[model samples]
Target: MSEQGQNRTMVEVHRVPPTPKASRSRMWTDLYSEHVDRAATSLGDAEHCPAITIAQLGSVAMIRLDLAAGTIQRTAEQIGYVAEPTYAFLLQVSGTASFSHYGQDSVLAPGDFTLCNNAVPYVYASDGPADLLMIRAGAGTIREHLPSPEQFCGRHLRADEGLSESAAQLCLGVCEQLASGLPEAVHNRVARNLLDAIATAFAISFDGLITASAVLTGRHARVRLFIEENLRDPDLSPGLIATRLKLSSRYLRMIFASGDETASAYVLRRRLEECARQMADPASAHLTITDIAFGWGFNSAPHFARSFRERFGQAPRVYRREKLGVGMPLRAVGAEAG
Candidate 1:
């Protein structure tokens, strides 16, 4: 075999051939776990502890993550200590994965696709060892169409339900082609085409089909759920939300207006309340005032302080110190003043 053929041999493809049920299940479990471990190590850090194998075919990085038939525990600290920015397209070839992102959790069964961002801390646990195919793309590329590119900074999004099947098939086809070891030029072109298709799939998946009102409504609900779940994202705004939901700015406003509040107000209230609750928690004594504020989506310390004072009766620092027993050191109080 040539060097190219040798590279191709590194990738193992399962055709889902006819076999006894027990035999197939065992084979899948082993393959999926090995693949996940390999891919996780290849990405930024083993600390991310992703058990998967990754293959680079041109611009696309194809990952086969083996999720053994059991619960896999993941935390922001485990995946990688630092938050990195990248886009991921995940396709489930077998079994299921329960994903938790921005406090919302969903189960993705076989043939389902999800868009995941590495900018946030989240966890995904599988039902058993399952096959997961992932494609990574640059941040700039995925950001262009996002209403709040930052909102997706650390989030996972499922393709609205209608588009999941088609997206899964397309991703599977791309993975198969990459595994075949085409010429470099052909591979690059194919990878780019696949990326475009994947992005389009995401765009349509989140926004729904333009032609079908029912489809659009369903898509709209998913978008709303995302917004509701991530209300503390400081960068959350109408434009960003609209872009992700694939709605015109005016229409997005109308959608929000139809409810009791405007989009911006809803996001702001949610963030403020979340921060207030965190500050009121006695267990949060170890965290600084700014840390609590930032964790709940307040970007500017002064702004958060001001907002807290306005919403409550005192500054966040004072509130935490007095109400939550988070005693502030003199140095820390001076830092907040400055």
Candidate 2:
């Protein structure tokens, strides 16, 4: 939010003076958890030197990380606290890093970047020295303009072509403004414009993933219908679907390629979505959260809890209460456990 004509409050964090290297890893983890998203961090095969810069532009945060080889993993099981969802736009300013998110893997070259949804699990890793830029914004506002943001997140936006190149230039411009401490008085407008630009870039670059109505065939419809009917089957999977449909698992994958997630990920997401839906329904209010989860094909309670929390940004019990409120019965599932 390097707003034009307005000064920004630059926030910088560095290593505490006189600390042992053996404790550096823990220190880095603490700093990251405090400043950024909750995650497990390690320098990993490189020196412990790490630097962070945070510039506040109202609700938007511009962050810079200069570090050596390292990895940071954010998991659902550890996402205990409740918070609003966020969208992180990570740019690789220098060096390289590989990322895994939304059931897809992507390698980022310099000038490449990716968008991330904070309500889900993700892994960010660098093999060597790297400089990274991240712009974080509230997910609610961003989601308003783009329906079904899944098609955008976790896909690499290369800097060499199309709308992605335009986004890269805008991001670089923000960086320049921040570094120069320019009071341009355009922070709010810049943030909004940046989000609009990035959303457009992702939509245009990965348009095929969403416009399924144009290319969806009878077979595709059948696959989807089959998934809907068998959602309660814990063993339901791509291979099983392909076997029953007289198709190869490979072809199933190809058909689903028009969407963002793989076939398996799609099934899991659907299950979670359904679980959330039922938890809020008045008729299902009597059912325990676990009962709903198990009825929806979840086999492991712990895994379901973790996945639900990660997907919904809150624990199952918390979600149930939020949805049902005091209307939830004393004997209902959420009353006893989360």
Candidate 3:
């Protein structure tokens, strides 16, 4: 896609207000079935219920089904109504739901989880009053990182086994956290990491069912190691770091923010410490102060000296002289003043 096309394809979610009764009636008559079909197709399931109320809170889609002591069953034939690719991360908050897909069938109680993809066809039913959280993201966004999007098209992934439990918990936590009003800066910083965590957790739970290798563990580990190794790189901003790591700069910021630090702050701290170490080293007694400062990636001598004093409670030259010995041979100050 062209950059403009890609930008247009990006998911930009807006907070939806609680559904009023009149609005609910109109939604049910006009949009509900179509909405359900879209959701079902993306998750590879046909969901049947008498009445379901949906609420939008930020990016989360919350649905409450009033089965009212009755039961509803959906068949694969009904699932064929859905046409688009999508993911359905369902969290059962109340009542019970029975799901059958991908040659597996299970009953989900409150607090349980079931994952669905709309790339294929499947079935689902519910009894009594049930509240569910359905997390949906564009198929394009998901498939970009998944290894086998086709295999996941029409399946229900149960979270009762393996890594699904952790993934389910993470999904719930993220939804709840997003629902709770987060500051704009912090929200942007944490959103993608939370999404990646949930996606990875889901992939692990489903084993190879979802085929999302890019969201797995190795990528995160490599990025972290890269950061640690290049701690002294002066140009190590989030965008540059992410480009080197082949990840979105937004995702990089989210990762660092999750660690309770901004990307720039993290790089700055690392560089500062590297300079401090070199300044405190005894072997560099022959080199002028500017050379020592510049060697550790400091671009400005005044800035480096000021930052050094603030961090170590002494000027860079004085700290170096005191720690590495002031009486050492003095190499002439050179033009390389960092």
Candidate 4:
């Protein structure tokens, strides 16, 4: 597909619709089915409707729900809606709410978070108007990075506490970043980091440490996040990142080795991708190629040109013109001249 076509496809995926009104007289009945499709049940006035916004990244989905006073339930039969077990990490963004799971119930004020396991059954209730951020992921995936996630399930982690607060903030931040729409490669790494953040948050809240495997997984995610945040620093290196994150240099290399590339290789790949994005963007048209290179941490012009071509199959200038709709026809002119 053409670049324009690709962009249109992305817009459709990241679209967040406004509050939808129900015209049907059986709006509440319709909501019952909707909540069922989402693996839940609702009890509220028929007039009350829900405002839901969804932002998806890979297997992780972030759902923002503005709901009226009601109770939502997940029954054993509803588990059939999904093939695999899944977990919903709910962050109560506003108003008062309560959660029940595994024979335990907890209340949450604004800023609190709790987990609801869909592998079994659970319930979430709100006293009045409620705003919630829900991060839903495959149960196996969460357990891969957070062994014993069952303990955290249905337990309220108050946001006022230190680690709990950090967890809430991280969930919000992850949703915001994912909603911005990122390239697929970068999106995968960021999604991993978000999962790690959630696992670590649970670990901290329980006054426990992540297992060895979980540590390695979490460290990789954290390092990826650090690299992305510091792409502008020309001095970004595994050693520098290890120092900043208080990890051993060899360990950092080992973490990235599990992927297709080494640490330095991954960094270079990301830098190249970032530079390409800038080149394709019309907003950066006024900047010189060399300036853009240096801005994304490429110190040497010749090195940047060579790497950019090696990765993208074209020179920076040509790619920019083709992408920004300026010099695409020049290729034919150049052929005629030849």
**Model-by-model lDDT, in order?**
0.56, 0.74, 0.51, 0.66
TM-score of each: 0.48, 0.62, 0.40, 0.52
What is the per-residue lDDT of model 4 for residues 291-334, given as tens digits with 9 covering 90 to 100? Answer: 77888888888888888888888777777777777644443212
Error of 4 at 137 (Å): 1.1
Cα RMSD of all models vs. native, in order, equals 12.2, 13.6, 25.5, 20.6
Native-vs-model 4 lDDT? 0.66
Superposed Cα deviation of residue 83, candidate 2 (Å):
3.9
Assess the local accuracy of residue 113 in candidate 3 as a C-alpha lDDT between 0 and 100.
64
Please report the candidate that would top TM-score against the real structure. Answer: 2
Q: Rank the candidates by lDDT, best first.
A: 2, 4, 1, 3
lDDT for model 1 comes to 0.56
- By lDDT, who's the top model here? 2
Q: TM-score of model 1 relative to the true fold?
A: 0.48
